[model samples]
Each structure stands twice: as structure tokens, then as C-alpha cells.
Target: MTVFRLPDLGEGLTEAEILEWKVAVGDVVTVDQAVVEVETAKAAVEVPVPIAGVVTELCAQAGSVVSVGEPLIAVGVAENSETARYREEEQAGSGNVLVGYGTSTAHRSRRRARPTAPPPHGRVPRVISPMVRRLAKEHGIDVAALTPSGPGAIVLRKDVEEAIAAAARPPETVDEVRVPLTGVRRTMADRVSRSRREIPDATTWVDADATRLVKLKRNIRNTDPDARVGMLALFARICVAGLRRFPELNAHVDAERHEIVQVKGVHLGFAAQTDRGLVVPVVRDAHRLTLAELATELARLTDEARAGRLSPADLTGGTFTLNNYGVFGVDGSTPIINHPEAAMLGVGRVSEKPWIHKGKVRSRQVTQLSFTFDHRVCDGGVAGGFLRFVADCVEHPEALVTHL
Candidate 1:
């Protein structure tokens, strides 16, 4: 018997939720055949069967979360069959042992099902993490009164807190009912935490007059009824130009290999705020796309991200990231660097501001650009120069057409 274990889907992910199982017991699977779909923090990926054989048992059911090195499925192989030979080959290390290994099918365990009993009046079913349960008990909150927001009616930490807060309010006061954070929300938290702790971030801010860019967008909107030029698309173009001027900023810092992997094409990730959480979807080869094309792709990505229809591939291979915090009426903030990437750009809120131009005071539409870089890979001078280049492009919107 050959056991299939959950594999690491990259980005140091140690566990994944079983989104679906493509194969069932008594079904035959071929080598490299996708047997299950698992969702990690980064994305959802299909895991393939290593050895061809009949599936004997599936340990984890759909929607069940499994840790790394846990046995997921068991494949039964004939004693003298080709699958047995392949298993032997795999054990001998002849075949690649990539990242995750196969599980041992010696014994299989079943997961316990949740109780189906209806709760009493004015009480909600609680589905909570082990840690949250202990915390709730300590806080004197009734766990049974908390509604579960986890997968398949499970309880979460946020659910417990919201329940406690609602319980504290008066009966006459209507509270906004709590909703569980799932799918994208869970994934975003993991990725953001990883990026924050792993990357060394440094930020530099510069103010620029976006008067010309705003006017150009207005002209486009006037000429073409369907054209909608947002600040993000304009900034994306500027990022591509800056990346072209300094190719070093367009590279990934591979710390394990101790090498800088320089990318030829420009793939920019636009950070969009969705109802679930912040998701950054990539626009591949932004340098080759025209302003209209960039606008279209950005719109599409933003819509998909907001709708939670983004695929795994849509979120990968980002050379750089842009966060437009200006829309929320905030001046500037030190944005966190996306891991592996050297830097990230934050566009602050744009508003009318007084400035001295040609020794004359004038009000202009100005915004602050915050460029956050990984200090380990880039110096202050290099980071400043890149920000200056981006600011110059934004200030002179007409110059972008020539580069395009």
C-alpha cells in the first residue's frame, strides 16, 4: 500500500484545507494524476498521485484541514505490479522527493462529526478554535451562545469576540450580527503576517503634483465614454517606467539560493480592497500594455478580486506591488513590503495643496508617494532614486506616452 501525504504548495505553507477530492476509494489513479485540490495560504492547488494504483482509503474528507506530513489517501498496489515497482523506485529515492512525502497507510483515522442538536432560544451554536475556547471561558463568555463563522459551521476567534461584545450591549440596542471570515480573509491574514515578519522594510515618502495626470484622465473620460482612468492604472504605468530605468528593482531576492533573480517582463500587483480582505492580483507584462489595455486589465482584476472569483494563477508572480491608500483620505503610511519582492509603492490621498511654483504660491492637486523597500537587498540611495523616478513620471504625465 502506498500512502499519499499532503504536500507543501510553496511559500513555507505547513497546512492546507482539502477543497475537494477528485478520486474516491476503489478508483484507480495514474502517476501525476490530480487526486485532490488543497488550498494553502498563497493559493489553491491540485495535488497529484505519485504512484499509479487503486485508492484503498481516503483519510481526510472534503473541507477538512490537514497538516504537513499527514497521510491523506492510501493506494493499494498489487504485489508484483508496475505500481509496486514504482513505489519501490520512489522509496529508493530514484524518483524526485520534491517537497512533501507520501503518507503511511498502516492505519487510518476518521474525523468526528459535529453535533446536529438545535440550540436553545437566544443562544447561538459555537464553533471556535481551541485557543479561543480557553480564552472565552476565562472571559466569562458563554461559548454556546457564540455563532460559528468557520467552515461548515465552525466557530472562530472573531466570532467569540463579537458574540461577547454583542452580549454586553443592552437588549434594546440592535447590534450588527457577526459574520465569519473565510476563504480569502483567512488566506490574506496568513500572507500578510508572513510578509511582515519575514521582510525587512524601509519607507521613503515624496510629494508630487498629479494635476496633469488627473486632467489627462478627465480628457480620456470625455473623449471615450467607456474609458475610466483611475489613479491606480496611472501609477502602474509609472511603476513600469521606473522598473525599466532600474532593472534591479524588478528582481526577486532569493535568500535561500543567495541570488537575485532578475525578471525581464514587468508584472505589477495592484492591491484592491475587497469585502473579504485586501488581495493583490497581478497584471503580467505591464510594460508592454498600452494605457487603455492597462486600464481594462486593472478593472477586470479589481472586479474579480472584489467578487472573490480570482484564480490561483491570478495572484502569483508579482514583481512589484502598489497600494493606493490615498482613496481613504490618508496622507502617507509606511506600507509593508510583499515578501520575496524588494519593494512596494504606496500612493497617499490626493488633495488640493499650496505649493511654491516659480516663486509664486499656488494650490495644486498633490499626493504623497511612499516607497517601502527591503533594506537587506536595497540601500537608501537606490530606494530614493526609484521613488524620485516614479514621482517624476507622475508629475509629467505626457512623458509616459513617449515611453509607452
Candidate 2:
């Protein structure tokens, strides 16, 4: 039995949730054939089998999560099976096989970390990693002249570069920082850097009386559990209503066209903080969804987001974003605009505080809402209006229908 282990989808995700099994036991699969859809923290990806054979065992059930490097499927190969002939032809053409995540191409054999060495060297030492040789060649530095610095007396890239640098000038003190920009962190770095570089962003904020919104949610929960609205859904509805009044905040700046692209629909994305990282899963056509529908979707997407089961489609094409930093028990935050979109609405935690509602002083639920916008799309007037509209809706949820 040939075991096909689960492969790393990306971003060094250690585990994946099996969403579906495409092939059952006794079903035949070919090279690079997708056998299952597994969801990583970033997206749902179809994991493919690397060999051609009859499926013998389905190691994981649908919805069960499995770790990387664990056997995902087992395939039985007969002597006369096409897998042998396919592998033979594959060897003749290319030495390796495609594994997972649709990374199929001419699979070239990766070089070993070090090359073979001579038995006894009258010269300096052995070289490790072909990169060391390449570095030495590029700099006209002789490996035999420099002492090996790594384990097993092997010449390293750093050693070669240091030798060249020492030859260039005497060792000098310098200040420089280096880091690996990779995975989701790398993606965030790129997007944030681009946003800072490209978008002229500005932030504005205001405090809202969320007592009525809280009371409304509480009343709904008390009466009907199924129709209850979450704070996120309430804010989402208000945001959609605000966007209707101040549509400029719900637009994107088109670089090529040099115009503000106003989106007709609200693909509302909410910031979901997870163990992996902060990901925004968009609820498509959110403006059309009722409060109950929005609550359901928000709950489902939030669950999927936590499970790392959101697909790529769920992560992109957002018209606007809602960030509730209050879940972390904070008052407010100037949320960064998810690029391509002009604005983001931030909700801080609602807390009990002394306030004068009507003629009497009492403790009421209060929360701060932060609104950030791209300066290119609109100025302070438009931003302030959008923010005030949202606040008004939060302070009095009745403004929702009027704006809609």
C-alpha cells in the first residue's frame, strides 16, 4: 500500500480539516488527482494524490482534521497496474512527481545540500550547498584558500561571502536589519506596505450610546433565540445604511482609470482574529441580507474563519470592512483600511458608564466607533458624515430603514 500523506497547503499550516472526500475506497485515482478538499487557515484547498492506484483506505473522514505528514489516503498497486509504467515513463521524462495544491509541473529533482567530495584534499575543505560554490565563483574567491566554518568541515555561503567581504575591506561595524518575509505574515507585510505607500489614509472616531442596540439584542434573544442579532450584525446593518447615505466611503480608487470606483453592493468583510492571524472573511452582498441572515452568516463565517476553513472567495473583493477590536476589551482603534477598499469601520467594546439619558443620570452601554478612509476617495466632510450616520444608527437603530 502506497500512503499519500497530507501536504502543507501553505504558510506552514500544521493541520488541515478534511472538507470532503472525492474518492471512496476501491476507486482508482491518477497522478495529481484531487482526492480531497482540505481547509487551511488561509483557504480551502483540494489536496491531490501523487500516485496512480486503486484507493485502499480513506484515512480521514469528512470534517475530521489531520496533521501534516500524516497519511491521508492509502492506495494499493498491483504489479500490472499503470502506476509502475507511469512512474517509468515519468522517470524517463522527469524524475519527480507533483504532490499537492495543484503545484503540478515538470517536477525537477532537488539538489542535495552538499556535493560529493574528494577522499583526501591537499586543499582547504569540502563545500556544503551549491550556493557556496556559486557565491565563491561570483566573487572570484577560492574555496581552497579559506577555512570551512560549518559542521563537518564544509564551506558555507556565509563563509564564502565573509571571505570576499574581508578581502574587499577590513571588517567594519554596520547597522542593518534582516527578517524572513514569508507566509501570511509576508502577505500582510506586502499589503500593508502597499497600502501605506499607495493610499493616503486618515482616521476619525466618535463615541456612541449603544444602550438601545444592546437592549434590542437582549429583547430579541429573550423572545426568540433564532432571530437574535449579534452586535456585529447590528453594526453591519448600520454600516450598510451609512454606506447608502455616504456612498463615497464604500468606493475604491482605481489606479489605472484614475477614478473612484463606487461599488453597487456591500461585500461586507469583518476582521476575524484567529490563532493563525487576523483574517477578513467577506459576507457577499451583505446589504441584501437581513439582520437574521447577517447574524447567521457572521456566525458561520466566524466559525469557518476560526477553523481555517474559509475559501479564497471569502477573503477578497470587499467593498468595506468592519473591525470590532472591542472583543479584545479595548475602547477603540484606528483600523487600517483593507486596500482596494476606501474605508473601514472599527467597533470598540461596549462598556457600562455613567451617562445622562433623558433627564436622569444612569449607567448605560457605550462604545466607540472608529472610521478610517482613503483621502483620495473623500475628504473629512464625507468621512465625518459617514461616521455620524453609523453612530446615529447605533444610537438609534431606526435610521437603518430610512437610509436603506
Top candidate by lDDT: 2
Backbone atom clashes (below 3 Å) for every candidate: 4, 1
lDDT of 1 by residue, 232-331 (tens): 8888888888888887888777779888788899989988898888888999989899877888999999999988899988988899999998888899
Which residues of candidate 1, in runs, are more than 4 Å off? 1-181
Q: What's the distance in Å from true for residue 52, model 1? A: 99
Q: In candidate 2, how many Å is residue 274 off?
A: 0.7
Off by over 4 Å in 2: 1-182
lDDT of each: 0.76, 0.77
**Steric clash pairs (candidate 1):** 127-155, 128-155, 326-348, 326-349
Give Cα distance to truth, residue 99, candidate 1, Å: 89
Q: Among all windows of ten consecutive residues in candidate 2, which has the lowest summed lDDT?
A: 107-116
